[model samples]
Target: MKQTGIPLAAPSNPNHSRSLSVGQSIRHSFARYRGVVVALSLGTLLSGCGVINNMMYKTTGDVMQGFSREHTIPYLMESGDLAMGCAMSEATAPLLMSFGRVTDEPDQLAVMLYLSAGGCAEDQGREHELAALAAMYERKGNAAEDAMIRQKRAYALASKRYLKSWQHHNTYYGESGTGECPDFDDDLDEFIYLAGLLSGLQALNAEIQSTSSIGVPKNVGSIVARASSCLENDKWWGAPMALKATVWAMIPGAQPEGEDAFDRLAMTDRLGEEAGVRLSHVFHAIAATNKGDEAMVKSVVRRHAESLKEQPANAEWAFVDAMATNIIVSISDRLWVENTGHRTPLGQLGSFWDDQQKEVETMDLDGLL
Candidate 1:
């Protein structure tokens, strides 16, 4: 056999050595990614052998859609462009759904599409929320009369998108433990099921924040409380605890006897810190912000900032890593935009509050941010 491709060579400049190293690194990553793609394609072909495959195209469609959702989505989100990300999701979701046309378990594909669609909507909703907050700041600075109107419109759109996210989640994971949804196995399947619950709750929170028109229903609280029990200690770190704490904090008189919302939040915060995934901190900060508890918000933000400084997010789960950054950065962005007319300070994204101790002054614009 003869080698045909270009031969590898060292760079002349030692400084340019990093370029070769980076290219090699990319090659290794692509090798692994290609293996996954090859495996899926092989599996798809192996399953499409005869009448059996014809009868079970549902399984085939599921495998293909899963690949699309898993591979395409994270890249779109990691691009750091929300409008483009949402647009990509909108375009890809229907392609995944089209796979369901030949499947018996059509709703299975719908569940996945709805979940992905909900996430897409959430990205748009957060963009709207940030814009609304910016508009509110403009009004505070004595802007034109239309500033208030723009703020209101932005909030309305944010609320509408969040409502859509919640509705999509509800369609699949209907009121936990109700036996109304599809069956799921343990391990990753269970984790995904729980994630749906978390997604629905998150959307509801956003909706309430933007419009104040929605209330935490008692039934939903009960469902989340019940669902939290299924999450084991090792599987989700503090996610289940975070969910419980969020429910307790949001619903009026929902906390159990001898337990407080802050206490639960603190415990979840510790767990998230240990796990090196600080989603609980985001939940805590948001809940505290809603309560107008500035101290608690700062506490959560500072702790999360410190943790992120200690260790950057793991790249193995880059979607979650990006999400953690997005949430924490949003907190910093809120503070900076309100105080200095900017987003997170340069190079101080995760450690903004802790390192700089930048105090966000209180403004008189209804505390919207």
Candidate 2:
């Protein structure tokens, strides 16, 4: 009844004859007017809205009937695909936790994440309860402990699923041939890993909030740092991906993969400030560990106050940016176990794209805009 991990595209899009090569996909993404390449195809805007209910779910018929194999498969294969995949994956986590079913494909993830966000945002009593039940599987401890445990389970499961999606879409070397990357970095795979780190950090943050689990939150930050380190000192694309990576790595004790990734992915442009925000998580972690300068811990909160917008013309760019937004917001929201703000934690739960409950929705971009 469910799929697994992130699957950027379908297995095929039969329209292979008309499909753009990997290189073309990247170019098409950047040219706004080109609007030529984006998968949104038709008036994709709200086509799938029905499937989501109040969440704007789309119906199956809209996606599948007209979708070409070419569009689906290549989308699945591309780097940005993971962004959607992770979103979908996390969006749907609550259902997976409740149903005890998980999917292997990332597209399915879209539905999960969307749902998780919606549920968490609105505080649907039943969905939240079901999510708590799902948390029981991986977390340990008592009732209060259990509630927290459930929270961590949600974050970790979400984090793990998202990690797989980013790893799947990116190559350690990046897609230079396709101009899909910002620059060269061996340790960092373009800015995509940034998405992984963002999702992971959010997971860790949420997990920490739900539970007093000591190790997980720290580890989440560590992963963020590691992902950042992956691109450190490298010519990061200055896109959302790199910025996200920087923020995660900057988290005081997040994932300490090493200084290498950091050096490789450092900012060469204005991206430094955004990257700095990610590091706030690291600093917060450091404060928690007593290894950091607590004074610096305030940076994250301050950074969020700083408005930063990186326009993403295509799926990959937008996906990464959205992932980063959630991660950062979650960090600020979950900065303390006190969850003192009473802000609802972002559900690091499931995918937003799990239409297995329905059918694929499609819009013929050729006719839409």
Candidate 3:
């Protein structure tokens, strides 16, 4: 009943995606992540290709065992970094929800990276290496000294504090200007932009506390201020996508309330070009408001809706869906030339996401997003 928690998304028919046997998907996933697969290849050959997620990473590894391909993925020697990167990748995956197998793990590996890296069986999202370091110092170091005990206690406290802060860290970033915004910067987590936001916040808090006498509070005031200015001025970098919806509403002769949130952003030309498809959503939004133009509205909405339907199921993201939905409502989406806005959503106005347009168009963005 619930697909990825987005009520609006049309559930994807398996037909939209190429259905492969477990072996096939595994082979494809393994091929792309060959470095990880090579470690497990021996097992694949020995076990007749049954090994997948279970063997690749297990609860505990045989540290003494030498390259047990049948039981383990050959150590990437790089999984440490891979783990961290994957964590970030997954966190950001929500933005580009359906890209590929990369995000398909549902950020599981990413979360595992945090758990593994944090070295927690319970998954508090701490960096495991940091935990191991404290353990090493606490038990191996001179336990005979009082300072040593105090030192260990301090480390324990620091770790706890870092963990607590992360639990409360903000992950909700506003993406739509149609609703209320909290002083414009309340949602920006620059430290953890995309996936690593909380971890980033946790890391920063830990680093500062580890290095300083008193823990410095997370100060995002300046960053948040700058982010708001960027939005007001249409600076897309480090900017929240929520403002994008407002921008879409601003096309002339479009929705009347759309202009309510319009702030003249600088570099309008570039931003317009970058968000052409998203901007197309503004036209779609306006089309929804046009009463007499039912035929044109339906045509525009259907065309954009079709594009949404055709959006890559693997790559269809939240913004992509929202933009597609927004675009269908835009009046310009239905117009050819004379009635369109000065800046068309992206280049032409139909569909966008350059990486998309090709492999994605056929996937049914509507069903996928």
By lDDT, the better pick of 1 and 3 is 1
TM-score of 2: 0.35
Question: How many angstroms is residue 343 displaced in model 3 relative to the true structure, after the best TM-score fit?
Answer: 28
Q: Rate the local accuracy (lDDT) of all candidates.
A: 0.62, 0.39, 0.35
Model 3 off-target regions past 4 Å?
1-233, 237-369
lDDT of 1 by residue, 184-302 (tens): 66454555566556655654654554555644442665576657776764456577877887888878887889988788888877777776667778778877987888667767777
**Candidate with maximal lDDT:** 1
lDDT string, candidate 2, 247-321, tens digits: 445554433465432332333223533433333233233332343433333344344334343323234343333
lDDT of model 3 at residue 315?
25
CA shift of 124, model 2, Å = 12
What TM-score fits each model? 0.65, 0.35, 0.21
Instruction: Find the 10 residues in a row with the least total lDDT in model 2.
Output: 347-356
